[model samples]
Target chain A: MRQSRLVQASLFVFLAAMLTGCGSHVPLEDLTISLILGVDLDEKNNLVISESSPVFNQDAKQNIESYQLKAETVRDSRKYFDALATGEVTAAKIQVLLIGKRVLEHEDWFPVLDTVYRNPTFSLNTRVVVVDGPVSDVMFYVPPDKPQMPLHLKEVIDKNIDRTRAVISTLQVLHRQMYESGMTPSLSVIKKEKDVEFTGVVLLDKKGKYVDTIDAQNSAFLLILRDEKKQELTLTIPMTSLGEGGGIFHKNQISFDVSRVKTDVKTSYNKGKFDFKYQIAMTVNVAERLFPAGRVNQKELEKMIEKELKNRLEDMVKKFQANKIDPIGLGIHARAYQYEQYKKVKPHWDEAFAESNIDVSVDVRIKSMGAVN
Target chain B: MKMAKPTLTLPQYIFLIHGVQMGVGVLTLPRETAEAAGTDGWIGIVLSWVLATAASLIIIQVMKNYPKGTILDLLRHYFGKWIGIAGTILFSLYFGIMATVIFIREALFIQAWILPRTEVYILIALLSIPSYLIVRKNITILGRYSVLVFFMTVWMMIFFIIPLKQAQWLHLLPLLKEGWQPILDSVGTALFSFGGFEIAFFLYPFLQKKEKASMGIVIANTLTLFIYLIITIGAFVFFSPDEITIYNEPSIVMLKILEFRFIERLEIVFFAFYLFVISVTVLPLMYMTVYCTSQLAGEENHRRHLIWLLIIAFVYVVLVPPTFDQNKLLQRLIEQAGMVLAFAFPLCIWAYLLILRNIKRRGN
Candidate 1:
């Protein structure tokens, strides 16, 4: 009993010593919780950093305030940010990273993102988005209706991602794509218009340079072709065969809400050129019909929609080929399915993709008419 | 001439061996194996299991002759007193060095991922305190602690479900694309992760159910095999072949990618919880070192012997600062030495004992 007492006493001493030694360590109360960070290039080509942190003081009027500085590296920018702030700046709670279009125009954006992945303190699950203009405009632009800018941006991206309007582009996935030679990196694009708006997705070439932007309407088509659609996506297509009678609201337009999309891609090499065939089968519900009820036959409408969808998908692929970008990861499929053939053209896959022939076909079935005949 | 030693049951035997074998090495097993063999690292895991099981059987065969004594007694009987003393000294040094490697490796892991600002020596000091507490106890308590550690860590395997959904199965295709040489080389690397099974050498004499001893060790090896196979293959499918080679610890990297609604930076929490699992590895080896040292000194009490070894571990880290590269080099060197001690040394001893038994019986 005496020995046990001695052991307990000694253990208590050790615990006490450890706790007192850590007294000088930084606690949670003294940290500036960074919710959103932005990176952009200024007029003189210097690196610009901006951060928005929540104002927790009871007397403060606004919920969040923004800070900006010009520095060489990400780690270097923190010093300047700390001087103007009440507490030390930390990235542990960062939810979104906004990159400006000017910074991405250069081919050296990967190094700027290196600190986020390399620094042990930063979280890799932070969502990365590209801004169509200067990132500061979006970072400081807080709408009166939204709770906070960071939370608002995160919810917008998350909601649209589930609805198949934007791709899932977290920092982890971006790092993987940047390292992979088979697929190029792409990010959801947000623009600061009258208010905050998710314009579409921006595609980067193999060199990490911005290539082109696809609008929300075409973003859904692009996601389906890439096999990344998740939830309900509604697409409105213009029926060209019907006469153009209406001016603003076209009477020839029809809308379909796609519930399920399955895309299969096959690649083959014939002679010297590559050939890809995309077989897309979609089960959709008719959300709206503008054509006259007398001219609408179930089978005929399905055929017309299928042909129009096929043409839209073909046009999207043509745009990708014209830009010499493989955002949909077709090269990944080629490498997986045809290892031997893909090896020969692996060095310049973009040029090879530009010269290839891609076939797009859509098979649509209207499952429900939504309580309307 | 003797002290009263405790005996362990069949389940304790299984948990003891399992807990020891699956430790700090698992955090980097996928990266090490992938660097050796491209996509066929799983084959290396199977081969290492086969080799480890065969070695365990040999150790068991040698122990079956001596009912109440350990390898120290067997060595004294087969060889002379001086050689037995030398052998005991060598094994003690082996355990000491292994304990240092595991302690430093885990401390480095904690520094790299969890607490970046803390000094390595401070981490070492803090980790060693709990280790001293556990190693000071008797073998029965250690066995119970091992069983507890096993149950606490088994639930972490469920976290892999989130990352498995994004895995690309095509990365594992075209088996043997590089041939068997790389697979064979990786088996050499993987033998180190299975190193702790040699603790059976000390545990055999203390097993209560002698009839089921070998069965327990085999089950333990098979369990470690599946654990390693799941983690290694999970990393293989999740990362591209070229991308996996860049990471030092692929398993933690996989956990870093996991996101929860309320929790951020889950790998930090995992490493914190994994401190228990890492302690199980060092505690048993430290106790074994103290046991071997006490036998060498002809003293039955282990408390003084354990303190001296812990002091040496504490001083060793402060004296020779180990960089990440040096720590990696030490791990590889230890793996090679461990292969010889755990695999080759036992087969030779078992063969010699068999010949001795045959010669004596033939004369009779």
Candidate 2:
């Protein structure tokens, strides 16, 4: 037994020495982990793919390196990126994917993203950003005095999403929306200016074609209607109906932070159409009252805000019906309660939603008026 | 041959059965259930749990007639030596194939997710070490290892709650939208997941509290049902009803949505730790095959048989690493075999026992 222990110890040491291994591991610094990938159509309407990677070697002149090549597909472009980089380009760590608006204008463009989903190594949390201009512009946009563009773009979207200024669109969410017939997909939209700007969100039709865009202001109402409000939802409304004093400074607007919102979609079929009534109860802390406190009483101010918010919401729903895009996923509620009617129209849910009756009612609860009255 | 005393407590019996039932089925259970029944497959899971629990109670009832002997002894006494040998060969074949399928599937997952470049035979060899080391021990240590492994890995369920933040509860709505046909069909698939409950047949004789064994299997089946329900519902809510059917392993793929400030690929770590829980399923079934074979051979020792079994299993996996279509066919075959052995065989023996009693009473 003692001699067997000697043999066991030696065998253990030998096996650990040889086989306690990485199959074929690459050191982190040696591999090119592309942080951002972009796809666009050039002037000739050819598919152009690009990627940006952070350079780790100190000898490189710049902190980031990028490549742009016209390629037919995302998988086809990898070889080009591999050929250009010092190390093999790996996409498992991609943070942001930017699609040019030219690409979104075409139907069946979702296949461009098939590579990410088909490959298990690619992350599902990578943010899918829609570039309002050219993908190349945003891919090349490097502002001075900022961190890497990928990190900057990710933080900008995360910060904006927290404030309810933009929608959150990861690749996983996009896959669900693209396949879900009950509702069309929407993604966060960004534009290339002096710096990268998160403009708002773009709405896609069932076939994954761009229909229309929602600006930052409309996006807030859209999110509230969709029941996707984030931590801080501040809306600046012009109180024209209340006839507040147009002072020399012209402070005729009220800005309030929506602390809580409750939206219930009561669905029923009426007149051969689906009818949805949205009962919205918004709790807000009066952050800025542009009108003088003495001018209006608290109850009257609450009534004014409620009336204004109701009109805005109704108008937003009207736009949704006109565009025939149910980004708010009201069809989800319809299917939940009114299944029989919803299934028949499921193939063309947005059109059925367009013909439906949507009623918007707002019940405003004032949580607090800032430190003053 | 030296044997330890019959010393498995009620909790140990429950964990052993529960842990073994949770095998590689979880990796693809949601998609399998969804393939047949859509999101309403949760109902099928509950139905299978019922069937599995009934079958488990029947096993306990059969064993209660002969307290000191295992199922092998009961078989030989009731039907004589020839039938006893036949039953042994059948049980061994069933358990052996189930363990082999589980072994290959575990290796497939490790190769696909964690180490793609490593040859599968090497991974199979690496996995075999745990089975050999643990199965070589007595039943008491098996029970202890299960209870220990359960506590060590149960906290991993908390990671699932993060994805619930984006969960769309409506995906589960319109339940039974297509009617009852699909839900009933997927019960076969769910029964395969509930297959390893028959390990209780071997464990019944060792249980310290014999009466508590019935309640233990009931609780074990309930725990398995609870796990299946949470994982299925999580997958259902995370993916759209239509989208859930697209991925082969939505349960594992669903983990890709988890991200943190410090970690990006959290599923890699989750899969690494999950190997412990998966082993609780593989090891006990491996030990049961060896034990059942020895009981037939009239040997009190099974450790030597275990070594040969592992060697055969490793060679089989290395020789026939199944492709995608081949894997599906293999799983279907095993599902049918398990349904017969775990569900159908129990009631048959119980009825046989009743008939034997009736005949003896008439003669008297």
Candidate 3:
């Protein structure tokens, strides 16, 4: 009995020493989890980091507390946020990362988000958005009639992504885009004029510098070309100006909801450049037909829609080439199919892609016409 | 002096081998093969399955000669008593160092992901408790624990579905673009992950059906390969070619992208539960070490040796807490030693035994 007691005493002492090794565990309410992180450059090119965290305590008057400070990097700004916050600031639940347009103008501002990738606590699925004027405008904006900005921004982006109205540039996807030699990064731009509005996806160059903007109408085509069509991709295109309906309203636009889309890109190399043929097959149902009854036969109407859709897709591709950006990931196809030739111009694929031959042909099969007479 | 070891059923025996083969190596294997080879590293995994399966069969063949004796007794019979003692010590050292390697790796994983502030010695001590308690029991308990742990942790593979949903598939394109040389080079790295099958030296006599040892090991290697290939291909398609080598543990890090409405920070929950899976490796290796030491010292199977081994583990963790880079170096060196012991040693013994039997037959 004495020996066993002595052994138990020694074990207790050893465990006591180990108790000092680990840190204290704070409850979740004590942690000021940053829901939104914003990065932008000021007038003097100094980096500005902003954070907005939800106030969990009922005593706090406001639901959210926000702060902005000038810091060298995202990691260094945590101290500033902690100083102002009542609790320890953590970036574990950050939902949106808003990058200012001016910051994207610089060559190497993508590194400003180094901590998001380095810190394991930060989620990789957080959506990334580029704010067109100042990220501060969007970051600090609070709507009089909405949920928290962080939740609202995430909801909007997710909804738009499902509708194929915008592109999703989550941290994980952005990492792949930034490093992939074949394709460039594309993130939807948001601006706060009076309210937060999603201006289309901003195309960035190979170095993550701003290149061009693809509007909401065109981003759908971009998504389709990339074979990233989501649950609902509805398009309303003006087929012709043949006749105005018997009123002041002109009825020439036809709306359709795409049910399925299959895209195939065939790559070939010739004299000095590569040739890419985009064969797009879309199965769509006519949602709304704003035209006079029996103006044209169904076959003729199908032909008109195919020609118009083909023209629109071709125009979209031309716009991509004009900006020297391959946001649709044509370079990915080029790499997959033509490795030997793609390797030579991998570094400068944007320019080489600009000089390539792209052919687009669409085959739209009407699956159904809506219940309208 | 002792009763016979409770015989291990085929499934328990199979789980024992499979669980040990998939240790810390599975976490970083994607990055290892990617750096050595390209996205075509899946080929290396298949090649390794064949090589490891064949090597394990050679061990079964060598032990089949003396069906009743464990590997230590077989050594003492084939060679002199002094040589057998030396062989037993070397085996003990190898298995003991392997246990230490697994302990340090599990600590490193926990520290980097879950408990960055906790001292590694505490983590090592904590791990040693379970190992000590488990290793003191007989192989029957250990075998049962291994099979239970396998079922408990196998559901974690379903978490892999999220990454595959967003897979590029283009990343794995242009297969063999760098040629077969890189894949062949990566086979060396993949072979080390398949190292635990070498424990068959001690497990053969404990198995119920001695003839099924070959078939059991073959099935175990296939299970290990299936898990490795799923992770290897999943990571290959999920991460771009250039991005895979940046993180040390891309397999675990890739799980960070998983966002379920019900749970946040699933990887934390994952690593915590993963300790059980990792124990499947640690407990068995620790047992192998303690059993080897007691057999070599001509002592009874008692708790004293296990206690000494745990104390030694604590001191090693405190004095020379291996950082990630040191972990890599130690892992490489240990794996090379394993290759020699598991492969070359068995082949040489088989050759020597073959020549001896031929001469004896001629004389007869």
Best by lDDT: 3
lDDT per residue, candidate 1, B1-364, as tens digits? 5656778888788988988898888988999899999778889989999999999988898889776788888888889898789889988888877878888888888888777777787788788777877888778888989998999888998876678877877778657756899999999889889988988888998899998989999999999998998899999888777678887778988888787788878989988888888888878888888989999999877888887887787788889876788988887787678788888888998999999999999999
Model 3 chain A: lowest-lDDT 10 consecutive positions: A241-250
lDDT (10s digit) by residue, model 1, range A198-255? 9899999987899999998888988898887776688998887676956887889889
Q: What does candidate 2's lDDT look like per residue over A201-235, in tens digits?
A: 99988888999998998889988988889889999
TM-score for each model: 0.94, 0.96, 0.97
> Regarding DockQ, does 1 or 3 come out ahead?
3
Candidate 1 chain A lDDT trough over 10 residues, lowest sum? A18-27
The prediction achieving the highest DockQ against the true structure is 2
Candidate 3's clash total is: 0
Decoy 2 TM-score against native:
0.96
Candidate 1 docking class: acceptable
Sorted into a CAPRI-style docking class, model 2 comes out as: medium
Stretches of candidate 1 off by over 4 Å are: A1-15, A25-29, A241-246, A267-275, B1-4, B358-364
Return the candidate ranking by DockQ, descending: 2, 3, 1
Q: Please say which candidate is ahead in lDDT: 2 or 3.
A: 3
Candidate 2: segments with Cα more than 4 A from true spot: A1-23, A243-250, B362-364
lDDT of 2 by residue, B264-364 (tens): 89999999988888889888888888888887778878887998888897787678865556766776797688788787888999999889889999999
